[model samples]
Target: MRHVYGWLLLTPAAILLIAFTHFPTLATVYESLFSKGSTIRPSRFTGFSNYESMMEDPVFWKVLTNNFWFAVGTIPLSVGLAIAMALLVNRTLPGRSLLRLAYFTPTILPMIAVANIWLFFYSPDIGLIDQILGSFGIAGHNWLGDPDTVLPAIILMTVWKEAGFFMIFYLAALQHFPEELEEAATLEGASRWYYFRRVVFPLLMPTTLFVLINAVLNSFKLVDHLFVLTKGGPNNASNLLLYYIYENAFSYFDTNYAATLTVVLLVILAVLALAQFFFLDRRIHYR
Candidate 1:
């Protein structure tokens, strides 16, 4: 009777998971093997043709490279800033609550709003950043227009947006640490840096690991900002893999190819997530 009740309890969640998550994943994989159908031509099994085409597509390669650089640029910087902000706010300081709220303000704003705000900042001459530059008789360059600057501009915005959310996790972790640890370190004449590096950091590894995985996922999944700020534009220079997948699925109406791209993305994320767990799990000191 207990086993029957247990099965009954598990059934709803299992059904939901299968219906929404597992089934879609399997369907995408299955769809990737077929060609896109139209009114004139029907869908047919292509058996990896879409994948082969993806390999040959230059835009795919460009988008993949952009995503790699985007991750490289955003993750470490965001994590570092998050840790710094957490440490600063975690200390007993005047107006720390306000400081924490200010740091976190960007995170709560919609990405579209963030993008529009930065879009104004990136606008030529009349924009805030440009106006500041112009004060020194410097000419304003279009931050989002130039291919060289667009990705970096986006990176900066992303770091600003994401760091505070990560900081919340770090702050929570810091809150749980016993004050005695800091007191003991001080009694031993341990410097702040030394204490943090040796004691506090080691203990925070689990939180760091959690934050890192989420950061990686967010790096790839973030697309709303792109839609508003650049539309992956100025010659697709700022295009990331997810936005490219969206273009293929919606703009080009090539859902089959989109499925292939999604599979690749899924594979990349799975590999990265698994690697992080496998490597970092060993170092995490769980409390």
Candidate 2:
């Protein structure tokens, strides 16, 4: 009777998962295997043509490079800033609450709101960044408008929004670290930097690994700000895989090929995830 009740309790969630997530995933895989023109008609089984086309598509390779660069730009900046912020906030500083709230404000702010605010900062002439540069007798080109500056602009926004969130994770890990370890090091007259590097950092390895995986995933998934700030321009410089997929599916009405591209992105994410589970999971040592 208890087993029956347990099954009944789990049934609704299982049904919902199958109806929405699992079923749609299977459907997409099926659709990706099919061939269809970019028309309003149904698609037919096209077997590997789309995959082969993707291999030859220069734009596909370009966008993949952009996504890779995005991850590279955001991951270290955000995670390192988070660790620095955590180290600051974990201290005995006064007005820490105010500092924390300021750091975390962008995390709760809507992506559109943050992007709009950043856009104003990146604007030429009257924009704050430009105004400051102009005052210094340095010319300021449009931050999001220039091909060379667009990706960096987006990367900067992403780090600001994400660092605070990752900081909280570091704070929790810091709390779990034993005070006795630090005290022992202090008694030995170990330098602050040496003690932290040898003791504290190794203890926080698990948390750092978690943050790295999360930062990579978020870098690929969250590009909404880029949509408003750069729109994958000027000339596909900021066009990451997900945004490009969105443009192909909705803007150009290429649902069939869009599905194929989405599957490719999924494969990339899956590889990242599997790497974490295999490598990071093994590397976390217990004290």
Candidate 3:
């Protein structure tokens, strides 16, 4: 009866998972296979039509392109900044704790809150960013309103917000590095860069991989702030895949098509996840 009791203990969580998460995803897949609108009662088994239609939809293609750039723009920038911040904060210095807190404060704040603050920063007249640019006799450009600048502006804020959180991951990795290995290199008269490249970096490889995967995932999932700031436009300029999916389901009531878009997103995420795992398996230093 011990085995039976163990299964019973697991039942509640299993039921909740199936009820909430698993069931909804499966339902989306089911819905994507059907005709959502263009019907009286909704749903007809027009297998693969929804997916095929996305290929031809110009708006869908545009949003898909936007999402690709969003991911490309955010992940590397965030990861690079995060690693740099981690290194800086790891040192013993005056005001180190305050610096850490300042960097990390954005990470804990709600994204909507950050969006509101950044909206002010991007304000055309007196906003901090434009105001600073104005000092040099440069015209104060509307950062978020311009198609060329919107994604990059959002990417900059996102990097600042995400970097400090990832820094904590690196800090933990830094703390656990075997002192002996570093000391051996130092005793051998190795330069600072040489020590970092040959000794410290190899040890932190696992943390780097973990943070990269998380940063990549965030690039796709964390587009909520864009809703408040961009609403996916100055002519859909900031339209990401998730925001586009939201537009379809709620704004346009194209539930069937939205379901299909969701499937595409899931496929994209799945591919990234697999790539992350493949790289991690090769890169992580087990010792």
User: Against the hidden reference, what TM-scores do the models get?
Assistant: 0.93, 0.93, 0.92
| Model 3 whole-model lDDT (C-alpha atoms) | 0.84
Q: With candidate 3 superimposed using the best TM-score fit, by how many Å does residue 271's alpha carbon deviate from the native?
A: 2.5
Cα deviation of 199 in candidate 3 (Å)?
2.2
The numbered model that scores best in TM-score is 1
Cα miss at 163, model 3 (Å)?
0.2
Candidates in order: C-alpha RMSD to true structure:
2.1, 2.5, 2.4
- Between candidates 2 and 3, name the one with more favorable lDDT: 2
Model 2 misplaced stretches (Cα beyond 4 Å): 37-42, 279-287
Model 3 regions lying over 4 Å from their true place: 38-41, 276-287
User: Which 10 residues in a row give candidate 3 its minimum summed lDDT?
Assistant: 278-287
Q: Per-model C-alpha lDDT, please? A: 0.92, 0.85, 0.84
Residue 280 local lDDT, model 1: 69
User: Model 1 RMSD to the real structure?
Assistant: 2.1
Best by lDDT: 1
Compared with the true structure, model 3 gives a TM-score of: 0.92
Please state the error at residue 213 of candidate 3 in Å.
1.0
lDDT of 2 at 192: 90
